[model samples]
Target: MSNVTSNSPSASNAVKPLDQGEEAVVRALHRVIHALPRAMDAELLREQGLPLVEYLTLMNLSETPGRRLRMNELAATCGMSLSGMTRVVQKLEAQGFVQRIRCEQDGRGWNAVLTDSGLARLEQAWPTNLAATRKYFLDHLAGLDLEKLAAAMRKIAT
Candidate 1:
């Protein structure tokens, strides 16, 4: 259970009124956080015939050793719940993009192995993903200190 129970003391304490500046920043961040993913997902769907999560799953696997990762770790890497990631992986497996194999050292766990088809899919998605990222994020931030903004984002994310 989370300590963030509604109407509890912790919840009350966790809530705080935002100052004018903070509220503006928070609202802007909130809008972008919600909107950007949708925009990117739409682009991926139209251009690559893939969903955002699928692209992310393939990309994550591609970057790892042997193009594979433990299922749990893959879930966390893609910021998905275990069951949610499992369903996505299953879809990929059905599509021949990946396969599930028994963990070499841990028989109790499974690993998601990226296939050549998955790499091809990721490659197909890359241009659209890059364009969407630039259109929604990087391009908008032009002529500012990106490092400072990145540091602020890191601070807030943590």
Candidate 2:
């Protein structure tokens, strides 16, 4: 097997230098796409009393049948690790947003179910979430650009 090193001369030589305009575009895209979510998340989440990840988890649970999902499945859907999910769910449970129940079929597994309060929170938060999403994201991109961006994201995700 060939070993790769960050300081290797061959690796350095293989990298093509980005031009000024390309660099500017890359930097601007990174800043706008990455920073906008954080800013919007902070503002919207603070007002709604939940973080973006928590809101997304609640929304995901709400969409499921009986507002319940297996812990492993929820982790996959949320793009989080099992341990990370456990922590989030624990916090939600503590706050009366969700409940952890033993899986019916599997004794070792657990399910996360959205509580009524969770549903109520989701209903109250949806408007601000939708408006912020539209204002910061959808409204800025053209139709063609949006399609292209979605396609690119799908490719990267897979």
Candidate 3:
């Protein structure tokens, strides 16, 4: 599509610029990626007294077997660095919502266990999380094929 010879390696591997419609979609996607989390965080903090990261950490922990996961696994699940998850778990531990204990399977590593209080707190916040998710995200996806969209998104994420 250019003056450069198509046989060249650079030509074959070259990236193309977005057209107008493509550019609009990409920009909107970028905006939603950045804005959705902040909006949801604001709503949860106002209504549930929980920040999105903390809520996510708690929620993820609550879903795991025995309500526990290795610290690194929890970090990965919450899209955080290990150190970041350590801080969150520390805060939750201080509030009597989570407990950090040595991983029995491997003596060197640690696990983050959701305390009974943590489950109770998550239950209290579940409605707010659901409402915020629908308001800030799902409400706009009116008649779209959600299953297909989710599959596409999962593919893109990988």
TM-score of every model versus the real structure: 0.87, 0.77, 0.90
**Per-model RMSD to reference:** 4.6, 4.6, 3.5
Q: Candidate 2 lDDT, tens digit per residue, 1-158? A: 12344776777776666777878877887799788878668867778877887888899999999999999999999889999999999999999999999999968999999999989988988887888888887787755577778998899779
Model 3 over residues 56-94: C-alpha lDDT tens digits? 988999999999999999999999999999999999999
lDDT of 3: 0.93
In model 2, the worst 10-residue window by lDDT is 1-10
What's the lDDT for all of these models? Answer: 0.91, 0.86, 0.93
- lDDT pick, better of 1 and 2: 1
Screening candidate 1 with a backbone cut-off below 3 angstroms (N, C-alpha, C), the clashing residue pairs are none
Ranking by TM-score: 3, 1, 2
**Per-residue alpha-carbon lDDT of model 1 for 8-75, expressed as tens digits?**
66667756656678778778888988999999999999988999999999999999989999999999
TM-score (C-alpha, index-matched) for candidate 2 = 0.77
For candidate 1, give the lDDT. 0.91
